[model samples]
Target: MKTILLKSGYSIPVMGLGTWLMNGRECFDSVLMALENGYRHIDTANAYENEDDIGQAIQTSGINRKELFLTSKVWYQKLRFKDVIDQCHSSLEKLRTDYLDLLLIHWPNKFIPMNETFKAFEKLVEEHLVRSIGVSNFTINHLEEALKSTVLPIAVNQVEFHPFLFQKELYQYCKEKQIVIIAYSPLARGKVFESDLLQKIGQNKDTGPGQVALAWLIKKGLVVIPKSSSEEHIIANLGALSITLSDQESSMIDNISENQRFINPSWSEFDA
Candidate 1:
């Protein structure tokens, strides 16, 4: 697996297993299969509610904890100082780990002062509870606010990104600031297969559309976490690492016209 170095001096896998809707036995089996088959990064969150199953999978895999990069997020509603601490400890307990490689603010909550939330994040880092901290679903405005709120480096920004919704401006901003962008929904919730362009690229490359999508993001130096519970898909998705895109192929995907978004809550401030 390839990795990108973070501003915090830590590295994260370029592609990871995304466990969003997966749960129980399915989550365990999928995670176990991923770990056994070369995936070293596992992305989950409190909202996913499958940390315990992932914990079991990791424990059963017999892989050293230090060898894997585990990332979890604090929910948007839990940004209060005490709530942040309590939620992180809860996540650690559920994930069966003493520390997290990366912890993030799942979403930007306007009601929560960025300073207070980042203060709790800093406290976690100071106590060796979290290695690095970041945010998710944040716009450039939100990131500017986050940059103003903390002295610690904002190591990453996990967001919904794919061919259809290429956030070029935000991507460049984070790049210049040294904040890695983790592309969740890198497949656009299965819509990748519907794209004639991605399908054409995949056919030309002899790979699936999903792999093409992941490869495109990887080519742009972004980390991707595409979710799957099927062992076949999991193994196939891992093959994305081997894909090498030509400049014209990359350009075709970049010019995709749709500005579609798959995940958006009523509270989202994407325009802001």
Candidate 2:
């Protein structure tokens, strides 16, 4: 797998497995398959309520912990400084790991003071519980607020990013700050499977439209995590690494950006 270098000098896999809605034996089996299929990165969260399953897979896979890049988020509800630290410790215990490759604040909520939350993150880094720290679903304004609290740069800001909901402004801002943008819902949550342009591109590449959508994001130099519980879909999603699109083909897909978003939770006000 290709890798991207973060400003922190850590390299992350260009593509990863996302465990958003996955659970039970389904998540365990899928994650094990992903590890066996050469995937080295996995994204999960506290709110997902599947960390125990994910930990079981890792423990059973027998893959060395050093080989995997694991990420988990602190849910918005735990935004208070003290609560953030306590929650992170709980996550580490559930994940069965002493250190996390990356830790992120799941969402920006008005109820929590950004500085207080960030201070907790800084402490985590200082104590060596987290290798890197960042934010998710943050706008430019939210990012600015986070920066004001600490000198440790934001390593990444994950958000809803697909051809239909391309975030050009936020993308540019992250680029200028050297912050990697981890794209969640990179396939538009299966909506891209029906796109005519993606279908045509898939046909030309002799792959599925989902692979085309993933290839498009890979070509744009963004990190993407597409989730699936099926072994067939996991294999097919990994095939995205072998395909590349031309500049014209990429431009054609870029034209399809209509600012469409698929993962809007009730608390979020930012429109991707």
Candidate 3:
């Protein structure tokens, strides 16, 4: 349960349970398991269509709201000012919370103006509906444009990050801007479990390869959220907190293939 300091002066858990591609009772059961375990952070989004299930999990777990850190996002299609405002309220309603610990723009909408979206974000913070605001899937240029305005503090940038998709420049830019880099898909979508190198490293540490990947990201000061529906994987993923990578091992992970990204969409502007 270590924490990372955000620019907005809030502390976020270094490890979180990512609820993506999970729905209904499965999502509820998974989240309940995570909370029952040592997890204090939970990540969901409007695009995921499972906020209600997540809310149900939270309500049933009986964990106090203040004791948990919940993060949800407004999807790309909902990037307009009006949509942003409405969606924030919708998300809050579905989450069964008066406010979100962190609210993020799910994706950069090339068609929408950044200032307009941020203005609504500012209003949310002003009204105490959101503690902090940030973006997801934002590259360096996207963040630069969003940072141009003095509307609000961009607290975090969650992205597809792992040894296979290591975004060095984006990571450094966020670091220099005091923006927390939240690593979604930190295990490379179960692909990390296939790598012999990761396995060897995990063997040295007496753990699994996925844990090795998580440990590497944690060692680099990045917050990681790896999604899992299985209780076994959920418990195993949390075990990553105990695995420490050597400087050399960290460097070894750094040199792994970086051309893979699991969550690419047709509308994504990754090359631009």
1-272 in candidate 1: lDDT tens per residue?
Answer: 78999999999999899999999999999999999999999999998999999999999999999999999999888899999999999999999999999999998888889899999999999999999999999989899999999999999999989999999999999999999999999999999999888888889889989999999999999999988999899999988899999999999999994889999887676234
Order the numbered candidates by lDDT, best leading: 1, 3, 2
Best by lDDT: 1
Hey, what RMSD does candidate 2 come out at? Answer: 1.5
Which residue pairs collide, candidate 1? Answer: none
Worst 10 residues of 3 by lDDT: 263-272
lDDT of 1: 0.93
The TM-score, computed over Cα atoms with residue i paired to residue i, of candidate 3 is 0.97
Provide the lDDT at 86 for model 2: 91
Q: Report the C-alpha lDDT of model 3 over 20-39, residue by residue, as the tens digit.
A: 99999999999999999989
Query: Residue 160 lDDT in model 1?
Result: 89
What residue pairs are clashing in model 2? Answer: none
**Residue 101 accuracy (lDDT) in model 2:** 86
Choose 2 or 3, whichever is better by TM-score: 3
Q: lDDT of each model, Cα atoms only?
A: 0.93, 0.90, 0.91
